[model samples]
Target chain A: MCATCGCGDDAGTRVSDLDGTVHDILPAAAAPHEHPHPHPHEHPHDHGHPHDHEHDHGHPRPQSPGTADAGHSPAAEGRTLISLEENLLAKNDLLAARNRGWLEGRGIQAFNVMSSPGAGKTTLLVRTIRELAGELVIGVIEGDQETSLDADRIRSTGRPVIQINTGAGCHLDAGMLQRALGALDPVPGSTLFIENVGNLVCPALFDLGESARVVVISVTEGDDKPQKYPHMFLAADLVIINKADLLPYVEFDVERCVRQARLLNPGVDVLTLSATTGDGMDGWLEWIRKNPHPAAAAAGSAPRSGGLRV
Target chain B: MHELSITQSLVEAVLDRTGGRSVTGVNLRIGPLSGVLPDAMRFCFEVVSADTPLAGATLTIDESEGRARCRSCRDEFVLEDMFLLCPCGSADVEVVSGRELQVTSVEVA
Candidate 1:
């Protein structure tokens, strides 16, 4: 099934390249992607017990006090209460960790760009690629429920791009990236931008193993967006106020939006820019140039959780 | 909703941990800032867990309040909403709790 939202079958999730070559993301057990790293599969705990207990379901088990109607109890007759203490998103987190390690190991700086639909994420990326054509090497991974339209736009910039259609899935999970990395194979020392599906809520919840998260909001989207989507802002490392050229016509309070974003994320960087008009584009480029690659900082540090399995 | 996916993950994790044993109860700890609605999760659990080892299992969610600690004044306080600001006028605050989404325990037979 779809790893992120589980609405459709896994066969619906797919990755397509500019050449029109499509790759199906199979179920986890028979996933087509291969692991480059030879790290062993690990779980928090694996309690192996012999299946010697008899199957006894004849009578109704005695329920604990106060749980008879609720059918919930810490201990029940002929039942084993196992304390799992496991994170619900453990599988996604594990895949994300592997992606992070692989990217950091190659000194690749990947940014997860998220915004609502029509927030101009593709516009910003296309502009960035054209402006910094020779100065930087950039690649992109476009995410959407369907269609390769955004990927085609990035392809026009002549950057290596891959499009992931989530089908019924609302957001892209780490598993999708893990599969895309095999195709993109981003060069070392290059920049990778993952354009997440246009949703303010679910995208922030999944960590795609990006070095940093960038949230883009346009002037037409109202200044109270930060207040409305606190999780997205709080998880953002930088917030780009796009479509700044419409500031005069629209009633977007830039100062108030920045203040609210900072309130949610104290250290978040806010930049105002109009991708179409090229106003304030220099600041955005400068921020990208100044941003440190996680690989460089983690050169001498111990590997997270012992080692990463990619 | 995202809760559907989350509920699926919860059921899968419990089944994997319990080795596909018949489960009667699954306890979860959800924090307010985790971006998950407990009611939606409960509903999704009932839908996804059907016909699986967790069929008819009760999903007990323990919702926790958002808590944070101010880095400037070292004061800990509750976050009534999404704002991370502290009473001392310092926006530099660290979330100490309320982002939990874990399966604490499961009753399997």
Candidate 2:
């Protein structure tokens, strides 16, 4: 959805890096031309667990490739049946897994940082990038419903950053991030941080093809954020409790919030840090250094639980 | 909500799967934890699928309950929210089947 009404008016997603290189992923109105060859390929009955990625056409540019081949079958009177047991988000997820493999193969780690508005996501990113300074070549893809305000902040840090204006959209989908990755082509061995549009619900649903997903929450918000928006925490490998400096004045409970976050994701690493005072910054920096591909830390085996406080 | 974009992707998936056939309806199994609202999907599918192969397609939604298993006691139960506890009172539960958004089948004409 364009985050706008389907009025059939002018609509597009704009992606631009700091150097003013822009690319517009035009609306579906112009989508027909892109489907040059609709080769039919019947998908197997995978139902809900779609993990087959063997259909590699060696398609050069994968921001969002053309769609073709697939079908479904169902019981209906006076109607034919085409059985298709797959997830609607299968396309996006498949593209995301492809992007993940590309990044992992090159030893490049990407982080999808998400949170509600004013959670200090941008601020925390600025601090983290500066602290990592000479250590890591960081590239950022900032997403917002409208402005490039956060992109400006990241640019001020002198790191490579691209801004994706979703227009009416609520969160950044894999297609959006995949296109952004094309613009902000961080070199191999570099880390890319995709700062997703400020949202807890929708952002969690769309995997931005990141090596790890980080959900940032501030103490200014309610401590019950995890309980209210469990999916965000559940999908995240790291939960940064930002704005710790305000904890003395705010009624937010750190222990309670961490416990709640842990309940949702037993494997999640919680870091209570103040981006303002640089207190507890090392812990997060350490996490970035040690396990760039945090998903790798979780994906291979049964989930593990451990608490390492700094 | 991103339901609009989701609905768009969903329609494309259905149309692509149909392979140029005239589709009548779609059967979906959506979990409560899938983050998709059945009513919103039903409402948006009409608009997003307009002018596409899936136009006039009905989206039949089947909401499945969230199920989780406790690692401690190996007990399985229905999970409603994040604050789920096992019958044996263990909070360390691994969600086995809650977040699902799949197209079970499609009726073609």
Candidate 3:
């Protein structure tokens, strides 16, 4: 646990390029020897749901008299309501905006590819790299729980790749992507693919400031996945139904999936492809080509802030 | 769940603004579409706020309604869940409210 930042063992997360260069993602706030608390792990074994005791904080205080909720108000019991109005994801959003600024400055179209495990994200990426090898200068930031295997696969294709092993983390945040960018240093006018950790839920909540978000689902999974995990589908700018080769054997309903996705995001585009057999690959590639880097238009100008720097 | 990490961020944001003041209540605006469960956050808050300036701070979650505006008719309707279709038989809908995950205020001594 980091005493300075309150970040936990997950702070040990790092970015590794194909050249074996490794960079620790988190700030060196707390060293291992400085574990002052009894529990060294970030999540303690105590699963006591203190939700019932939320109001009973052992301090008795009356509510504010009025409904004016913006400023500080002295309550009847002498406590002050100091309005903060701060977004919970502000920190991540700031980092994501910085990442957007950097990516936009270089005319690099970065796509955040997210999906459940075994949904063939890496397979599709590998196939894309192979198919677009001559036309595109592609770079990848592969995120996994703790493995360089996917990065190795991307490296085998001869493109620059960086692996971010998120230790015990369910998803990749903007800070991790920023650190990976520093190591990868992808060239300008290239396509940067950020393969997020294989989790549909947590990754949707985080904004990595990518040009677009692509959620991949395989036919082996339930067709109702879009409805089951609406947040993931809602965040997706493009939904790719992968593993089309197994569509004949599986019970996945492509129409229902597309309908569910469209219900959440009417503007979302859906593509069905079998990465292994190269079926429906043209549409996928065309979509990538059509959706150019969002930041490319703002190139040569001052970095556009996401309302962070006024 | 991811609520733990979110709660940690909430604690940090609150403590950052408090300036060493002992916080008594932390008010938040959480919407259903925010992809955050208030119950899970409440449980995580108790765990993350331990030994900090926000220790024992009452987490008051204000759940916002999920509302959306139809692009065709401009009629604002209540969106209960992920089914984002508008009542005007149109699929194009713009999210007006909901999806709020903000730390509105803090009660301090």
**Most lDDT-accurate candidate:** 1
Docking class of 1: medium
- Tens digits of per-residue lDDT for model 1 on A1-310? 5444232465477887546476665355543433322112243333476444332434234334334333235466666666666777777777877888989988898888999999999999999999999988999999998889999999988899999988777888888887777678889989999999999988888877888789999999999999999988978888999999999999999999999998888778999999999999999999999887766677422221201110
Q: Best DockQ goes to which candidate?
A: 1
Which sequence of candidate numbers ranks them by lDDT, best first? Answer: 1, 3, 2
**Higher-lDDT candidate among 1 and 3?**
1
TM-score of each: 0.86, 0.82, 0.85
lDDT per residue, candidate 3, A12-85, as tens digits? 67778558566564344422212123322333334354211123323323245443454434442655666677
Error of 3 at A9 (Å): 3.3
- Model 1 gets an lDDT of 0.78
Q: After superposition, how far is residue A296 of candidate 1 from its true place, in Å?
A: 3.0
* Candidates, DockQ: 0.53, 0.50, 0.44
- Model 1 misplacement above 4 A: A4-11, A26-73, A299-310
Q: Tens digit of lDDT per residue, candidate 2, span A1-310?
A: 3322221224567888667565566344532212222323455545365343343333221112122223233344545544566676765666566567667666678888999999999999999999999998898999887778889999999999999987777788666766676667778888888998898888887765677778999998989999998878878889999999999999999999998887767778999999999999999999988874534443421111100010
lDDT of each: 0.78, 0.72, 0.77
Full candidate order by DockQ, most accurate first = 1, 2, 3
Q: Report the number of clashing residue pairs per model.
A: 0, 10, 0
